[model samples]
Target: MTIEKTETINITSPLDIETVEKLHAGDRVLLSGVIYVARDAAHKRLVHALDQGEELPFDPKGQTLYYMGPSPAPPGRKIGSVGPTTSTRMDSYTPRLLAAGVRAMIGKGSRSAEVRESIKEYKAVYFVATGGAGALLHRTIKNVEPVAYEDLGAEAVLRLLVEDFPLIVANDIYGGDVFEQGRAEYRRGGN
Candidate 1:
């Protein structure tokens, strides 16, 4: 489904810090605000930044990071078809990111054990977008600008203003995981 991008939304729902810590698997959300963009390369750079005691390019506290590497947009488009990439590749850097104050991650697949535990410990959430549904996601994005790390190709960081973009919680701080639930619902030759 496509939703036309309209007014820029400001997500002011302080997201009850306690409730945010309990976001559950299969829950849907309308992210009416800003989020940071990061990918495999940017994750590496961030860890190194931590090692050097440098401030992250953006604040992680109460912030969400979308794990993606987008295709260049064609003329007249705010951004190319953008969607979350597989997330397991980010496992190594996630604990560190969580420690640095990140409260959520948006991506396509399930997180590793270490990442999931960190979410539990840090009061964080993991949201999921439709896999392979880039064209549809693009309709929700109205503009694009980078905050940092511009030399890493599409892996460079960028900020996007999105409106009512659809997503489902894949993992939450409460130890629930959607992938497991989905798998349990379906089995070999079974629906």
Candidate 2:
């Protein structure tokens, strides 16, 4: 199949509804600013805290969450080998977080139908980072600090200050899903 040229879009975190609304599936993005890092363990805790009527470690409103875990920093660097995890593992908790006002998420794969619906209903977006490119991904992280669930070690939720973090829109607020589209195109012989 031939690849279409997609313009790279530059965006910042703490994204607003207006910004998310403008994004579409298949568009490439360079995300800058703050993003919270969380994995399955951290996701569970965040949802549990919400269930107990407690505030999250960081405000979800207008913010982006990256489903990643970082290896221990090597020497002077602040982080090492940060990469996106499989998004499906976090699907069950995603709708709740989206409902709580998270504007976007960065991960590596397709989402569940329910999560896709929630993305539309909540005006949020899902982005896919390149899998198996942890070393390259780490270059964009300008700062990293522990945020919550310290005992989880690498799985702990941390705050990341990123510049030009690479991603592609996997699902958009308008019900667009790039994975589905790509599959359909392939089946149709890329016509």
Candidate 3:
């Protein structure tokens, strides 16, 4: 099999539909701009608020949520080790978030088939950060502010300004899945 060169794209957050549409699974990206931090606990609260007709802390439209629970910042630091959490835990809440107009999600691991279908339906994308590169990833985060659910501590939602945050498009609006492709490639002895 022929290996194609991957183009690296620099993107700003609050990603527009047009920008998200252009991305495909396996594309490398450096995202710079605003993104929200959330994990499973936060997701549950967000969904619960929605269910009760309560206003969400942040608007979901055109937004990107990164699945992370960061450690406390050291002296004079914007953030600590802001690592991507395992995404599967948030799978149940994902489709609801997508329907609310979330444009992209950043995390690691494959999503459930239901979540993947929802992504395609909502024209959203899922991105994966290198699982063990939290320290490196933290460097890209220029600003961080707790936004909601502060009682949750590290699980509280945070607004983040990131510069050149690295990610790979693991699943895309067009139904591409990089993980499956990689596995297939390996099985065929192409990698």
Segments in model 2 whose C-alpha atoms lie over 4 Å from true places: 1-6, 188-191
> Candidate 3: global Cα-lDDT?
0.92
For candidate 3, lDDT tens digit of each residue in 1-191?
Answer: 01222558888999998999999999988899999999989999999998998889999899999999999999999889987989999999999889888889999999999999999999999999988888888888999888999999999999999988888999998899999999887785544
Candidate 1 clashing pairs, residues 3+ apart or interchain: none
What does candidate 3 score on TM?
A: 0.94
Stretches of candidate 3 above 4 Å error? 1-6, 188-191
Off by over 4 Å in 1: 2-16, 188-191
The RMSD (Cα, Å) of candidate 1 is 3.9
Candidate 1, residues 92-157, lDDT tens digits: the string is: 999999888887788988888989899889888888888798888888787789888888989988
Whole-model lDDT values for every prediction: 0.81, 0.92, 0.92
Q: After superposition, how far is residue 80 of candidate 3 from its true place, in Å?
A: 0.4
Clashes of 1: 0
For candidate 2, the per-residue lDDT at 177 reads 95
For residue 96, give model 1's deviation from the true position in Å: 0.5
Q: Which pairs clash inside model 2?
A: none
Report per-prediction Cα RMSD to one decimal.
Answer: 3.9, 3.1, 3.6
